[model samples]
Target: MQDWWNAFMPYPDVDVGHASTGPLSGLRLAVKDLFDVAGYPTSAGNAAVLAASGIKTATAPLVQALLDAGAFFAGKTNTDELAYSLIGGNVHFGMPRNPRDPDLIPGGSSSGSAVAVAAGLADLGLGTDTSGSIRLPAAINGLIGWRPTHGSLDNRALRPLAPSFDVPGFMTSSLEPMAAVMSAVGMPATNDRPISILIPEDIFETIDGVIADEMIASLRSSAMPIRKINSIASFSLADLAVAFTTILQKEAWESNKTLFEQSPDAIAPDIAARLRAGSRLDDEAMREADRIAALFSREVNRLLCENMVVALPTLAMNPPRRYAGPDSFAAFRSACIKLLCLSGLSGCPQLAFPIVSRAGNVSLSLVGARSADRMLVNVARRLSTCLKEQMPF
Candidate 1:
């Protein structure tokens, strides 16, 4: 039933959904393999990790909250092994099919969750975002992905991947379901729209020229007007990417080295080598990375202060074509990291909401101040309401 996209993990016997009437009463929830479910196994999409992770004895706090709010459990979805890669092709469990085109990589490590939601198999897909996992897949699949502020929610029992960047996140088809999930999870109510748009000076130049015009035109749409716009100082994508990679690699190496070391063949050879390289970084490099990260966090927060949100293209180009050569995937992934690293480095809340045009479907993300998750969603809800329908999400 939920397997058409290979999105839901192959587990039919572990049934655990609380039936009650609440805010999310009619929604079916898809949990990513990174989170624990009481009766289900958290495979984390790797054969070796699966062998080590026995059946979870308790449900994670966030998952329990959604279930308590009356969301029907669909099933645990697949993820990139140890949440490492963004391409979403699991060498172990097979890549989840992208329902949108079927030929594009469903941006991951939240691959299955995004595929399931996009395929109409579930209404809400609970995933994690560490450096664009949620946003990338949601954008590629034409869905709304929300990455909340780091540590803003109860994140117990989650397998860590770069603890400083990991945040529990979700993807949904539209604005309403996203709002419902937010309210269901006990987030505070938002009455007023928190919107004062900020555009980076060189964003258009940074992304590929192919869709740059479409993104530019979206700014003039009634949904996101340029009437009240201001310019935020630009940032170097290359510098940010390098700094982000340094921190992410060090943390990932510390968190997941043992798993790969214990079962080297269980993990992909390339990823294993990456982890090893991260472990080998000298202390001086690590210190410089931390310094840059801290400085950027302050700079971004200051710029996005007082309800101002930065709106930009969710991706640099588009999802890599499925089954493409390693070179193609690498170039696309690198370009995307430049676009996405700021959100992770700064710990801001980012919402990847759909923007439809004759150029086809693309997403524009609103990056807001930390802990302003509800505010960002409410702002987008207003925009979606005003935008022309039938534009094809």
Candidate 2:
């Protein structure tokens, strides 16, 4: 029989051919393809990118940290090509089936990382969420995925799409390992007062009905009640979507322009088209996007200050089906990318807890102020406990 994981499958045999062990001995890890892992090819879910870039010699610091913790390297997982899209399908590597419902998407660019953890294939998996890539998949796959504030986790030896937004993140089936991974990576846990959660209805609009209902029920049952932020003005998610897309495409184009120029034929057609679009962006548009990003960041900080954490649906819609046609794929793919940016724009820490399953899927996300990652992880730990007790997960 053919292997179910296909090209998306990671190398499971990892002993590193060495005799070193430490605290996290026997634990398994799946590193996203975007992160350099000594011998594995950084495919970034595209054959062309891998062929052009070749194997990376160094391991990311986060990966090294895990190894120091005594975790065995499982292998590299799939990602959205160039870490650009959120939908999991790679035109090159076949998309991994979501463990919840293979008919639906697994969510991306951290697609394989989420699937690996959700399916119990790995104890922990590294995933990069440029735009909800980490949290969205965790929500869809019933895993705990955390993104630390920018720079809280190092990004060295990793590929970049938007340097400002991209950060190394990880996913696990439970909060315990998630916390352990974060702590081992050097994020200090700080105890806080009572937990305060902010619920912004406008953004919550993008959440599916089943998840919204479950979250509301969860809030009502919790010892701490959630507060609605009334003073915050709503920016058009659509407009923000446009701005976010334009800025990222432009930035990605600039960052990878050299590669594109050297071998335009090497880049995938869809990605090449996106780079062409980014090329059209003038300095003025880029500057305007910067202005908007700054403004939005300030407002987001204020909303998060009122509460220790802000809660939102990790993905706007249920995991979409794997589209067969290019047009259908592009449309579904774009929406997922835009929604992923909500947390990405903040550059803050996010902890995605698997609170409840709806329609055989999961939904849970915790957004925190920048540099308050440890506290956010604690909040997720408590929430996960309450969920397990109430929902019997």
Candidate 3:
């Protein structure tokens, strides 16, 4: 599987057995390289980081929980260097191919996890989402990607991107496996009643016209009552994006400063440049970013309370072409950050699911109130079933 997809880091295959009986008994899972696997060094997608990291003495509790529940481990998948980029093209390890369309970029830094699941190499794949890493890949590759509310899941053994925004997430082809995995980790059960849906007019308008129309049509066909809101709060999407980028860069720089300073050349040039830029951010800018983020979080929470959900496009546009030059790719990423920043800023749970459109596959996303992880999954399940029956597009 690794040979075909380039989805895994270069390491000997390691498989751990599951118990004879449990909910996930026969499932095969692939973990991102960032998680601590007992006796294996966590590479975090960089050769130097791998070399500097000593073997882990214990496994991440999340990984242990899955193993204890009867799921078998399928080795580590590749990640963006330091999990910094959403493009998923790692300079150190080669890009993981998008199984659905080989020429397109697989969304990342969770790139490999999405590929593993989409290609049927693994039943489930673990990845971290910090600023849309999980959801973006899930959207581009036509899979279910989930980001639990901030602090809902423990992050002790996972690699840090921006600790404030990073959360452990997974990618699967369908909702059932995702629900089973969440149950094993003790996530709360979802409410099964009908939910109130809110469409953020500004955010939806950011998407390409063709994709937006397809997404709207799908929502309408669900026969669920939907309301359009001019804004989630006083903040615009651009404002949220700026605030997220400012704080994320500041924290990311702090998290990886030592590595960047010690072995600058060991990191990929594009990622290294971004880190260097982060290091230059001043205290005043970060303080303002924090202030804006706090206000945004409060407003978003208010809007999503009481079984309410927000729907929007996962990516403003489709995935960029493979090897799109750094300049073009950078622009595309900036545009996407405008939409992705909403989830990060508000500390809410978001689920990205695929919608078949004339342009191929595009993604539709649902954002739920903070700590409403299970509800978002429930919504995705219902929406997925409806789409299949209606085939609205």
Candidate 4:
């Protein structure tokens, strides 16, 4: 089907069957291009990869589980090249239309998946989150997005970007469907009612002044008690971003190097530059970046252990316009990465729930500790008067 939004990858009648009875009964599921599904090509959003692939022999175990749980396959959605950038436009397959605003970019890697759900083409969107793929788009498009704690869900049969950071995640238009998916996957529920909300002073400081003021004001209006504290050991956002990019470059290059090696011309110019950046990093730099990342993970996880959820703007700014200039996009990405790297490095469960204001469509993300995925979902459900009204769920 040629969707108006270009959310799905073109395929020849890619069919999926599901159980008659299960928690996910009759739910429409949109699969990201990265996952292997029987009877369809697994392109991973790169034309070279698409050209090299054939119909997969076996469905990914994760997709199988969802199918068994009774979710019907909607279609495979578009993604960024090899699932790399945060903003959506793919060089080969055109960018997925953002249901929120046509001109605004749907957040990337998981862009098409998010668009699928937001545009009412699917009940749930299956995507992966290494950095902000799921959460970022969910925020921009006003959908509920969950990046499960790393390793809490199956990652097998999905294309690897950074193995240590890659995790299977999903997007949905609302809460009940998300809860059903969680139940189908057997994610245990948590009683961790958030006792406090941690507002990292440094994160807000990095945002543009108007957006910062609006976010803080919005949070203050919430019923949950908020605590402002200095964090990251005096490390600037650039430091944390550097830590994430350095490690991702190394791991991503290693995971997909063979593809690049075989089809040297397949890599997009931007993606190639990122891969080269990683390729040139010396072994020692990778190790040092890893060390810093581990420390940050521990620090963030420690806060979560106390039943405190970290709350911040999901993306540092509103989504950039489509086909933005490279220099401008690069600068924009650098700022956004700092906010995204928090959950990426920690491997914690971060959920983005939309909260639209007169200013624009913005979102507040609540991050829980590892394995606290269900808790954040529950927290979203318990949103106070103001937040509840803004929630699509």
Q: Which model is ahead, 1 or 2, in terms of lDDT?
A: 1
lDDT of 3 by residue, 206-322 (tens): 877767777887788887878888989898778789889998988899999999889999988888888988999998999989999999999988888878999998888767888
TM-score of each: 0.94, 0.90, 0.97, 0.95
lDDT of each: 0.84, 0.73, 0.86, 0.84
What's the ranking of the predictions by TM-score, best on top? Answer: 3, 4, 1, 2
Which candidate has the top score in TM-score?
3
- In model 4, which runs have C-alpha deviations exceeding 4 angstroms? 192-194, 232-234, 384-393
- Residue 106 of model 3 has an lDDT of 89
What digit string (tens of lDDT, one per residue) describes model 2 on residues 1-393? 133653244444434422267656677787888877776667766666677766567777778888878888776787777877767777777788788778778888898888887777788878887777888778777888887797778888888887878888888887778777777788876767787887767766666776677776786566666787642335666766776777888888887888788878766688789888998999898887777777777878877774468877666665557655676667665666555666667667878776655444456677887878888777777776676677654
Segments in model 2 whose C-alpha atoms lie over 4 Å from true places: 1-3, 7-21, 231-234, 324-339, 357-360, 391-393
* Steric overlap count per candidate: 0, 2, 0, 0
Error of 2 at 68 (Å): 1.2
Which window of 10 residues has the lowest lDDT sum in candidate 2?
10-19
- What's the distance in Å from true for residue 46, model 3? 0.8
Residues 110-177 of candidate 1 have per-residue lDDT tens digits of 99999999999999999999888999999999999999887887889899889989999999998889
Pairs of colliding residues, candidate 1: none
Cand. 4 TM to true fold: 0.95
